[model samples]
Target: MSRTVSFTQMKDGTREEYELLRDLEKPFLRLTADRVLEELRRQEHVTLEGYKVTRLEHGLQSATRAERDGADIDWVVAALLHDIGDGLAPQNHDRMSAEVIRPFVRWDVAWVVEHHGIFQMLYYAHHYGWDRNARDRFRDHPCFDSCAAFCERWDQASFDPDYDSLPLSHFEPMVREVFGRPAYAPEVIREGHVSPLGA
Candidate 1:
């Protein structure tokens, strides 16, 4: 049988109850990669900008490009997940996707996911009368160029219908491996760390 906490409210819980909850967390953490992959798979039903590919395919293409370019596992995974939020939070998908991966990948990878929307604006924002140069506001930020390059090279250009993208199964192991790392390693949190592609 499973253990249960007797308290109905957090404030009423005893330390023993809290410890039980903590113990449960370990198994839940191990399932994070599976949940994330399922969420990405759900993007197959979502389409954007009249693109010829589903959002899932777009994600696969982005990851495939990064992998072929010899990016590390972190970069490849980040690329794979960068658009996972389009179905739930289109208006602020970047922030949502970034938060989802923040705990698993390097800080710069999270930053790129967080800010790719803004950097991507440099492409079509002008058509909507928004400032195409809006991303310039962060010109001096350390990760600005990296974020811009991500949008320019991968995120912005991944809408093709003909690009041969890898199967999601090919990336399942990589996802599990990246998410299996410690959420906040001290070395990765330091300043000036770049992704494998140096972008």
Candidate 2:
């Protein structure tokens, strides 16, 4: 399998546009039988996909959804690589996010990737009742409990139902992957804004 996908081919095939959008997201998001499987190397960690979560699948899904949602290139790329840190340790991914994204992307990428788990602190602490040690560790993380404002910013981002149901504003764009061209023409960007909540 190749690290690259023929994103253009997927977007233009003879299918309902929305369906094509979703179809493009399938292989990496569900990598068990992906065309790119051969490209992945075996690792010690177990991930949602055979490849580490950060390698490609989650990155692709986040970037793809981000573009459909109308986020900027930085935001989409942020979404794509946000979990890159998770490749190291799924439990505390932000630290790794900061490390990996900082090198390849930008400070913004490091910021968002670092904070993806910020909102989860409360989720894990209050309802899940993680032990004091675990809770303390989570709370101490730089992104822990800080995403409310970050989330607010992205909460205002636009989404396109024709391409995807997820909001894109919440993340940094990942235009690098599709920089040469787009999977689709970004018709939703042309049509007009759609609410992240409904669309």
> For candidate 2, what is the TM-score?
0.41
lDDT, each prediction: 0.86, 0.44
- Candidate 2 Cα errors over 4 Å, as ranges: 1-56, 130-146, 149-199
Candidate 2 lDDT over residue span 1-199, tens digit each: 3334445765555445556556777654443212112222222133455333324444445556556656655455555555555555778877775564344443434555676565435334556665423434545544333344333333212122233433233332223333323322444223222222112
Task: List runs of model 1 lying over 4 Å from the truth.
Answer: 196-199
Per-residue error at 178 for model 1, in Å? 0.9
- The stretch of ten residues in a row with the least summed lDDT in candidate 1 is 190-199
**Tens-digit per-residue lDDT, 103-183, candidate 1:** 877888899899999899889998999999989988998888889878877788799889999999999999998888777
In angstroms, the error of model 2 at 115 is 2.2
Pairs that collide in candidate 1 are none
RMSD of every candidate to native, in Å, equals 1.9, 15.7
